[model samples]
Structure formats: C-alpha cells, structure tokens
Target: MEQLVFYSLGLGAVIGALGVVTAKNPILSVLSLLWTFFCLACVYLLIGFEFLAVAQILVYAGAIMVLFLFVIMLLNLGTSEAADFDTARAMGRRLPLVLLVGCTLAALSILAAQQVGGTSDEARADLRSVGSLTDLAQVMFGTYLLAFEAASILLLAGTVAVVMLAKRERRKNAA
Candidate 1:
C-alpha cells in the first residue's frame, strides 16, 4: 500500500513538473508548480519527514505560490490566447509515445526510490532520530551555524536586490 502511494505521488509530481515546463501561460505554469509542491509534500510525509512536509506546504505551497500569483497578476501576464496552446491536439498526436516515455520514467523512479530506501529497520530508526526537527536544529545551530547564517544573509541580499529592481521600474514609470 505504501509503495503504491509512493509511486502515485511520484507520478503526479513528474506530471506536475512537466506541466510547469510545458504550459503556455505563466499562470497555468504557476498552478502546475503548486501541484508539484503538494505532491512533494505528500512524498515527504510518506518518508516520515513530518516537519519538512509541513514546511513545504506552509512555505512553498501557501506563501510562495501566493507570491507568484500576485506577481503574475501585477505584471498582467495571464491573458494568453487558447489558440496559442493547443495541448490536447498535441497530446492526441503524440499520446502513445508520451505515455511510453512517462511510464518508463516512472518505473525507473520507483525502482530507484526502492533501492535507496532499502535500509534495515534499525538504520531507518537511527535516521529518523537524527532527522527529527529537534535533532536537525541542534546540528544546524551547533555545527553549521556559520553556513546557516551565511545562507540567511545571501537570501536577504537577494530580497533587497529584487526590491531595488522593482522600485527602479516604478520610478521610471512615475517620471
């Protein structure tokens, strides 16, 4: 049952990722991206990464997707014509080949996951203990504090850069 669910979620994630890449409109691409994020959270839940799953949902699916949609709306990038994106006709033309490739990739992914996840019960328990949020926090703060701080600073720098770029465009428009 668990393996079945893992495979299902894996397939959904793959399809969602393909949708994100192949969708014509940016808004549809964002929706596809949200599907991918949700499927990833489910896969993490299956692996017992409760904290990671919740963070994925709360951070990426909730906040980040909202931000993406807001940006799309602000930029007015969602008025794409249907004639420009005839996905159904394309899929109908190449349906068999696409299905063959998709199934092949999905099978490979499941096999890979099974091979990687074939550790003994004891090893898995040890990993769970080490991977718990509290244990992870201790290691991150105690052993990798410098790297963590550096990453935070890098992200802050990126945020400031984006804000500056947006304001620069606005200043020009106002002038």
Candidate 2:
C-alpha cells in the first residue's frame, strides 16, 4: 500500500511538472506547481514523516504559492503572449539532446530501483522514529541544522528580491 502511494506521488509530481512547463498561462503554471508540491507532501506523509509533510504543505502550498500568485497578479503577467509555433519549432531542434538526457535518467532510476528494494520492517521502524513533531524538530536542529539554516537564508533573500522587483516606478506629469 505504501509502495503504491509512493509511486502515485511520483507520477503525480512528474505530470504536474510537465503541466507547469507546457501551460502557456502563467497562472496555470503556478497552479501546476502547487499540485506538484502537494503531491510531494503526500509522499512525505506516506513515508510516515507527518511533520515534514505538514511543513511542506504549510511552507510551500500555503505561503510560497500564495506569494507567487500574488506577485504574478501584481505584475500583470497574464497579458504576456504565448509561445508561437516558430518557437516550438526551434525548441524541437533540442529533441535529441532531451532524449539522451531522459535515457540517462531512466538508466539511473532503474539502477536505483534494483539497489533499493521494497522497504523492510527495520526501514519502517526507522521512519517511525521521527514521526512526531517533537522528534522531527530534534532531528532537524541536531542533524540537519546546516541545511535548515541555508534554506531559511535562501527564502529570506528570495523574499527581499521579489519585494524590490515588484516596486512601481514614479512618473512626473507634463504641465
């Protein structure tokens, strides 16, 4: 059951990512990104990482996506023209390169699947260790402090950049 959930989450994320890439409308792309984040949170839940799952949903879907949508709306991004067929044709020239990369990724995924078989009882037990919010916090602060701090700094910088970019220009009226 857990394996099935994991696979569903993975497929959902992939499809959502494709939707984000292919959707011409900026709003639709942002919505697809929200779906992608939700699926990832679900995957975390399936793995018994409840705190992580909640944090993912709260930080990503709740805060980040809202901020993204607000910025898109504020900037009047809806009026941008869609990509033309000529652009698609140009992009088609890279098909061979994309296929090569896809093949390499598929090979790596196959090898990873072979190496990491179905989860055993011990693996399940380990997942239960940090299932609680308190345990998850302990692990985050103790084991993953550096990664956590880096992410916080990255978020802070992104927020500042967005605010600066969204500022409007002042214009003087001719008498």
Q: Each model's TM-score, in the order given?
A: 0.62, 0.64
Clash list (residue pairs), candidate 2: none
Lowest-sum lDDT 10-residue window in model 1: 78-87
Candidate 2 weakest ten by summed lDDT: 166-175
Candidate 1: tens digits of C-alpha lDDT, residues 49-81: 877888899999999999989998897875455
Question: For model 2, what is the alpha-carbon lDDT of residue 118?
Answer: 68
Top-lDDT structure, candidate number: 1
Q: Per-residue lDDT for 108 in model 1?
A: 100
- In lDDT terms, how accurate is model 2? 0.83
Candidate 2 runs further than 4 Å off: 84-86, 118-124, 127-132, 139-175
